[model samples]
Target: MRLFSLRTLLVCTALASCLGMVGAQAATKAQPAPKPSGQKVAMLGGKFAFTLPKDYVKGPMEEIDAKARAAGVTGSLYMNKPAKRVVIITETPLPNDQKVGANDKPTLDGIIADTLQQQQSSYKDFKKLGEKKIVRKGLGMRQLDISGSVDGGRVLSTTITAAYGKRTAMVNVISLAKDAKAHAEVVKGVTGGK
Candidate 1:
């Protein structure tokens, strides 16, 4: 028969518990940090270029092209982020023979209206965060913040529409997660620097 002393048993149990706690902590510490959405974002074309977080990746500009085609509009640019990435959508109003509208400048209402049409989604989904004037490097600009979800909970996007002259450009920065604060920072960086 083998017998263990009480002191030995106590010491062994304590060591085992300590090891278990350490192992649990180590497992947590070993886990990788969550990755950024890698959505594509736009920067103001001026003295410098600003961008979204690394997790955000650029989506195809094809949607912009499609909108231009459907609206019978010309010379429009669209930039989208990768899947689940936030995107910025921009539209420009230029002299196009196909366009029946007559507006010297792009209006916020008009732009948003077109966006709903192009995306084939109703404006009801967007919760408007209001409007503000942005002045960057002595250049006066205006921007609007809008956000909503898409793709059956797979993709969520926050779009910041910024207009310049006869040309309008929108940047849709999106992610699988909702991030109002980060989106505001992105809008600030894009609007303030441009």
Candidate 2:
């Protein structure tokens, strides 16, 4: 059964934006880290703040396209276009009546399960890698390790989701699977591992 609305997991949370898949650009070189954006985005009503990495370019939330915005995704997006990598940090408001909370294990646990199911249903050749419950940035979050084929190519994805007081924040990193080391480093950096 679907624990959350289809909107919550709509089309892989903007991952379907034709990120120019992995195999096509398997030999792409790493672009030099770009200048940092000198701003911080506050989340969880100012309980947390995020700074975009110097290695990727930041695009306005509107760039995420209308479908994602309609699904209630409001946050930042970063991309290293030539490198075939994308990072989406989104803050989505949740309904007051749902089974959700920052500290609610059951809610998060169910989400991870349903999230995997949603991806399996959405992507072609979706594969489960590994996943676990983790604490990041002082919030209990669920992380998924998975891969699948999308519009442009196959990509590896590390998705971390956490809820706190009326809102849920997700850090989704999608990159060419061949750039495993680079992708893992970015995920670690953004999540602030415990």
Candidate 3:
């Protein structure tokens, strides 16, 4: 067994604290992944791909699409179900305008926060697993874990938000009528950042 010196102990504790702070900073700070702003590429298991909203940012070229695929979700739909419908939304960070200040928040982050707030109206069961810092497609990102139910069914939701310069995205994954744990697992797998 190796001896434990006071200096060594202090160093280890300091390192652990620094690591924790880094994680916390990463969780709240902006990420580095560029949103898919240009050509609409096939995403997630070849289910579908169309021109994203010009204002919308894009995810990393790789797993962002892959995560969408695993979620078994397709393009955004115009209609909403009356009794019960599972809603999934994904957002990517857009390029920033140089005129804007760095302190400006990403649009996608706003969207996700809005969606979560709106969910308060319809969802009976609401719980947040909190936020985590993640890396997707070699870019820094944030993964938010949310759980709840709408129309008497379970919903497992995950949002991957990326901030590239002035833009940010919140990729949402919502599931229905299934075990919350299982649903979250699927969503994480689909988003490709978990």
TM-score, one value per model:
0.46, 0.75, 0.41
Q: Give candidate 2 regions above 4 Å deviation.
A: 1-18, 21-27, 30-41, 61-73, 97-101
C-alpha local distance difference test of each model: 0.38, 0.67, 0.39
- Candidate 2: clashing pairs of residues: 21-153
lDDT of 3 at 75: 32
Best by lDDT: 2
Worst 10 residues of 3 by lDDT: 1-10
RMSD of model 1 against the true structure: 20.8
**Model 2, poorest ten-residue lDDT window?**
1-10
**Model 1, range 1-194, lDDT digits (tens) per residue?**
00112112222232233234433443222222223334334433432234445644333443334545465322222222222223434444433432322221345455545543443342225455455545455444445445443322322334444444444445544433333444455555555442
Better of 1 and 3 by lDDT: 3
- Model 3's alpha-carbon lDDT is 0.39
User: Candidate 3, 39: how far from true, in Å?
Assistant: 16
Error of 1 at 83 (Å): 10
lDDT of 2 by residue, 19-81 (tens): 534434456576544333534556777655556556577766564467757766576777776
